[model samples]
Target: MRFVWRWRRNPLRRRSDVVEAWAGVAAVVLMLVLGTAAGWAVGSFAHGALREAVRQQQQHRHLVSAEVVRSVTGTPAEPDHESTTGREGYGRFLARWQDPDGVEHTGLVALHQAPGPADRFPLWTDDEGRIAGRPMDRATAVVHAVLAGAAAAAGAAGLVEGVRRVVVWRLVHRRYAQWDREWQQAGHTWGRADAGS
Candidate 1:
């Protein structure tokens, strides 16, 4: 890990040693600079896109009161489960709602609790009265952007490290090959009277 000897005027130091030392320094600098820049750029882009999506959804989506017609047992393919907010899906019901454009629609809607006939609950819908999921809130969007940014930063750093390792490996191999060639020449003159002279 020490590069002091590479920089000094040592007879044992090969040119490749100095190159490896400089390569390490460059790799470290690149990792820091590239990681930070990539993270920031990705985070900012994600945040802006998410915010725009939120705005569009809010503008186009509408919340309407849906009246339960009847409850039905969930099928295996559509088993009821707890939502991300930890609310249990007690059952599903055939519900009817009218969109802002006065268009009526009916569909299976999940309820947190057993619903009696004619019971009403709020439901989100699109312009055509089709059911829709809730829009992403600003806070959730920000969190997602941050996580994406962190992943990008780590990815960038990992790529830089991998490149550095590959370069060092090739340099080491080249140095070993050079040593092998020198050893072969030395072997030819081994045990000769002039070998050490």
Candidate 2:
């Protein structure tokens, strides 16, 4: 049968079928308009929030120069593409530094090259004087925001599709039930010679 049969003047078409067709249209509209809008809004919000965090981290953290107390002899972990600039592959070392108050501290720190015991390195520290990595740059913050937006959009569209599927499935069941009843009504006189008349 043609897909538009529900809109045609057919005696066999049921009211449930028409409702299902309208629901299908609504689903497409929602996926296009509401879903896309929701994704864009969430993405924008995420970008702002992440960028703010980056700014705050920059404010709260301070850089301090430290000297390597001992050499890091063991091999360092493989650096991925996202590692800080100049830190291409593998390198980290134990270093010590004094904060603004002259308090001494030591911890593992990543460096572009192995540091000698006498070598001095610059490292970042949070307000509590704990070692910290560089803050999120603008590019990285945007990337994270975009990813979060995409995830939220997919979730919204999936929910709409699921609801559409359930409604259509129920309509199909009703159609089958109607057919079964019709078949039963016509089946009782199947063997009678005058049934066709």
Candidate 3:
């Protein structure tokens, strides 16, 4: 692994040793710079795109008051019941809301509390008065971007390390085979006046 001695005056240093040393340094430097740059670029682009989407949703989506038409109960079966907000949720209920343009829409709504007939609840609507989920927020967008960037960096690092290992291992094998060939050539001719060093 020590390459400094290879460049110095040495009887045992082979050309392959110098090549391996330089290649190792180059590979490490390149991986660091390229991987980090790629990760940052991907992260920044993703963040900008996601933030724009959130902005559009916030601008167009509106909260309208709706009246529950049917009583809905029972917790829905969820594969992942874990809630990040640490709050329990109520079931869905049928509700109707009138849009700003005077068009009315009805859909299933999830509420924190049980809803009876004529109970008022807040409903999210898109620009065309269609029922929609809650609008995306800036915080969620940033979190997603950060996670994506980290994943990119990790993936790049893993791939680079795997390739480096394979190359180094092959180089070691080749060096050993070269040593064996040299030994076989000089095995029976050592210390002879005709077999010169």
Best by TM-score: 1
Q: Say what the RMSD of model 3 is.
A: 4.8
How would you encode candidate 1's per-residue C-alpha lDDT over 1-197 as one tens digit per residue?
A: 36787888889988999988898889889989999999999999999999999998888888899999998774332343222222365576788999998988887777777879998899888788877778788999999899889988899999999998998999999999999999999999988998893
How do these models rank on lDDT, best leading? 1, 2, 3
Residue-level lDDT tens digits of model 3 in 128-158:
8777668899999999998888788777877
Greater lDDT among 2 and 3 belongs to 2
Every model's TM-score: 0.84, 0.77, 0.71
Itemize residue pairs with steric clashes in candidate 3: none
TM-score, cand. 2: 0.77
Candidate 1 yields a Cα-based lDDT of 0.84
Give stretches of model 2 more than 4 Å off: 1-6, 9-12, 72-92, 100-102, 110-112
Q: Candidate 1: worst 10 consecutive residues by lDDT?
A: 77-86
lDDT of 2 by residue, 22-67 (tens): 9888999998886788789999999999999999988877789988
Instruction: Write the number of the candidate with greater TM-score, choosing between 1 and 2.
Output: 1
